[model samples]
Target: MKKQMKILDAQDKELMTVRKIEREGNALIIRGKIFGAMPMVAKLTPAEARAAFSLLDMKTILFLLSFLFRR
Candidate 1:
């Protein structure tokens, strides 16, 4: 069995498929298409994802957020 996850854009379109994801490892590798066209591959580390993505709540996520803001 192959473990995979779908990555969707803001408009709900399929952006990419996360074919291989190892959070505890050094990098997260993805294989999919762009704009439903050309094939593409990307590598992102945990550190990069944490700094660039605000929606991620991964293992080492920095919770700079405060509860007071969630009203």
Candidate 2:
């Protein structure tokens, strides 16, 4: 699956543009550009992914779930 999205700040300013996100083996790869110019790439392993997600509070998780279950 291919998804192109723009990450915006609270003021609606574009912070980053996500060009692609994909899974490679057990890792998640994110390719994007910061400030619409600088190239950035991140690879998150399963352990790292879990650890990162663990930082989310219950309220945030519920808010995210709302989007997931949206029609």
Candidate 3:
């Protein structure tokens, strides 16, 4: 399953378009484009994923959870 998402800048202009998200082996891969031209790929290991999530505060976490649940 592929879920598409967008990243907007402060002016609400699209900076990145997340084209696909998938799991390969033990890593999570995020494929996207930066500034509409540069291709970008990020791989997150299990430990990296946990560390990344740990950076989010309670309010942001709650907002994301609410957004997902509302869908």
Give TM-scores for every candidate, taking all chains together and pairing residue i with residue i: 0.43, 0.78, 0.76
Distance from true position, residue 27, model 3, in Å?
0.9
For model 1, the stretches where C-alpha displacement exceeds 4 angstroms are 1-4, 22-25, 53-71
Q: Report the C-alpha lDDT of model 1 over 1-71, residue by residue, as the tens digit.
A: 77766779899988776566444468887676666677777888878878787766664344445534656
Q: Candidate 3's residue-wise lDDT over 1-71, tens digit each? A: 66679999999999998998899999989999998899999898999989989999999998988896684
lDDT of each: 0.68, 0.91, 0.91
Number of the top TM-score candidate? 2
lDDT of 2 by residue, 1-71 (tens): 66789999999999999998899999989999999999999898999979979999999889998986788
The candidate, 1 or 3, that scores higher on lDDT is 3
The local lDDT score (0 to 100) that residue 38 gets in candidate 3 is 99
Using TM-score, rank the candidates from best to worst: 2, 3, 1
Query: Lowest summed-lDDT stretch of 10 residues in model 3?
Result: 62-71
